[model samples]
Target: MDLDSAFAALGDPVRRSLVARLAHGDATVGELAAPFDLTSQAISHHVGVLRRCGLVEQRREGTRRPCRLRTDQLALLSTWIDDQRRTWADRLDALEQHLTDEGADR
Candidate 1:
C-alpha cells in the first residue's frame, strides 16, 4: 500500500467519515450518501479517492457496488503509527534518564 497516498486520502473529513462508516459494514454508494448533504456522485468521488489509496474496496453484487473498508490496509496505517509512537517514547525515556542522571550528579 502507498502510505503517503493513503494518508493524504484520509486527510479529508468526508473520506474519513466514509471509512468510519465502512468499518461497521459494507454499504453501497447510495447507502453511504444518505447521511451526507452531498450528492451520491460526491460520495462516489470520495469513495474513488479511498479506492485509489487502497483504503477501500468495492465489489459488485447484483445492481449494487458496495464499498468495504480494507482492514489490512488500515492495519498497515496502525502499525506505522505504533512504530512512530514507540520511537518517540524511547527518545523521551532517554531524555528523562539523562535528566535524572544529571540531577543525581548535582
Candidate 2:
C-alpha cells in the first residue's frame, strides 16, 4: 500500500468515517451512502479515493459490490505510528535523563 496516498485519502473526515464504518463489516454503496447527507455519487467518489489508496476494496457479489476494509493498509499505518511513538518516547526519555543529571550536578 502507498502510505502517502493512504494518509492523504484518510485526511478527509468523511473518508475517515467511512474507514471507521468499514472496520465493523463490509458495506454496499447504498448502505454507506445512507449515513451521510451527501449523495451516492459523493460516497462513490470517497470510496474511489480509498480504493486508489488500497485502504478498501470492492467485490462483486450478484448485483451488488460490497466494500471491505483492507486491514493490511491499516496495519501498515499502525506500524508506522507505533514506530514514531517509540522513537519519540526514546528521545523524551533521553531528554529526561539529561535534565535529571544536570539537576544533580547543580
Candidate 3:
C-alpha cells in the first residue's frame, strides 16, 4: 500500500483510536465501538480504512467479526522516517565539515 493511502487512512482520529485499541488485543466490532459515541457502521468505516491500509486484519469467529493489529505495516512508516532522518543527518554533517574547512582556512 502507498504511504499516501496509509496516511489518509490514519488521518481520522477515530481510525487512529481504533487502531490503538486493536493494538491491545483482538476485539469484536461491538467491543471496539463501545468507547465512541459513533454508530457501529461509523466504526466499521474507520476499521475499513485501517484494514485497507494493512494496519489491521479482521476474521469471523462464528457470528462475530474480530479485529487484530498487523504490526508489519508499521515497519513501512518506520523505514520512511529513518530515511528522512538519514538524509537530514548527511546534510548536517556536510554543513559541519564545510564550517570546519572554512575555519581552518581563516
Candidate 4:
C-alpha cells in the first residue's frame, strides 16, 4: 500500500496502540480489545483499517481470529529513511569538499 494509506491507518491513537500491542506478539481479537476502553466492535474496526494498510494480518484459529504484525510493510518505511540518509550524506560530503577547497586557497 501507499504511504498515505499507511499513515492514515496509523493516524488513530487506538490503531497506534493496537499496532504497539501486536508488536510484542500475536493476539486474538479479544486479547487486543481487553485493554481498550472501546467496544470489541470498535477495536475490530481499527484492526480492519490496519489490515487494509498491510500493517497487520488476521488469521482464524478454530473460532478466534488472531491478529499479528506484518513487518514486511515496514520495509517501505526503511527504504524511505535510507533514501533520506543518502541525500543528507551527499549534501554533507559536498559541504566538506567545499570547506576543504576553501582552506587550501587561504
Candidate 5:
C-alpha cells in the first residue's frame, strides 16, 4: 500500500466523504455523487484518486461499475497508527520514570 498517496488522497474532504460513504456498502458513481452538488465527472475524478491510492476499487456489475472500499489498506493504516501510539506511550512512561528518579535523588 502506498501510504503517502493514500494520505494525500484522503486529505480532500470530498475524497474523505467518498471513503466514508463507501464504508457502508458499494456504490456506483451516480449514487456516490447524488448528495454532492458536483458533477458526476468530478466525483469520478475523486474516485480515480482513491483508486490510484489503493483505497477504493471499482468492479463491473452488468453495465454499472460499483466502487468498494479496500478495507485491507485501511487496516494497514490503522496498524501504523496503533504502532505509533504504542511507541509514544512507551516513551512517555520512560520519561516519567526518569523524572521521578531525578526528583528522588535531589
Candidate 6:
C-alpha cells in the first residue's frame, strides 16, 4: 500500500469519520453516510479514495456491498508511526545525555 495515499485519503474529516465507524465493524455505504450531511455520491467518492489507497475494501454479499477497514494496512501505518517515534526518542535521549555530560565537565 502507498503510505502517502493512505495518509492523504485520511486527511479529510469525512473520510476519517468513515474509517472510525468501520473500526466498530463493517458497514454498508448507506450506513456509513447516515452520520454525515454529504450526499451518497460524495460518500462513495470518499470510499473510493480509501479503496484506491488499500485502506478500505468493498466485498459483495448477495448484492449488498459492505466496506471493511483493512487491518493489515492500518498495522503498516501504525508500524511506520512507531518506527518514527523510536527514532526520535533515541535521538532525543542521545542529545540529553550529551548535554548532561557537557554540564558535568564544566
Model 3 lDDT, full chain set: 0.88
Q: Each candidate: RMSD to true structure?
A: 0.7, 0.7, 1.7, 2.4, 0.9, 0.8
Model 4 error, position 99 (Å): 8.9
Question: 1-106, model 3: which lDDT tens digit per residue?
Answer: 6788888888889988987898799998889999999899998888888888888899988998999988788778779989999999999999999999999999
| Candidate 5: tens digits of C-alpha lDDT, residues 6-69 | 9899999999999999999999999999999999999999999999999999999899999999
Backbone clash total for model 1 is 0
- Over 1-106, each residue of candidate 4 has an lDDT whose tens digit, in order, gives 6788988888889998998999899998789999988888999899999998899999988998999998888778668779999999999999999999999999
Residues 1-106 of candidate 6: C-alpha lDDT, one tens digit per residue: 9999999998999999999999999999999999899888899999999999999999999989999999899999999999999999999999999999999999
What lDDT does the true structure give each of the candidates? 0.97, 0.97, 0.88, 0.90, 0.97, 0.95
lDDT of model number 4: 0.90
Stretches of model 5 off by over 4 angstroms after superposition = none
User: Which should have the higher TM-score, number 4 or number 5?
Assistant: 5
Query: In candidate 6, which residue ranges exceed 4 Å CA deviation?
Result: none
Please give, for residues 30-102, the per-residue lDDT of candidate 2 as tens digits.
Answer: 8999989999999999999999999999999999999999998899999999999999999999999999999
The better-scoring model by lDDT among 2 and 6 is 2
Candidate 3: 10-residue stretch with minimal lDDT: 69-78
lDDT score at residue 48, model 3, on the 0-100 scale: 88
TM-score of each: 0.96, 0.97, 0.85, 0.78, 0.94, 0.96
Clashing pairs for predicted structure model 2, backbone only: none
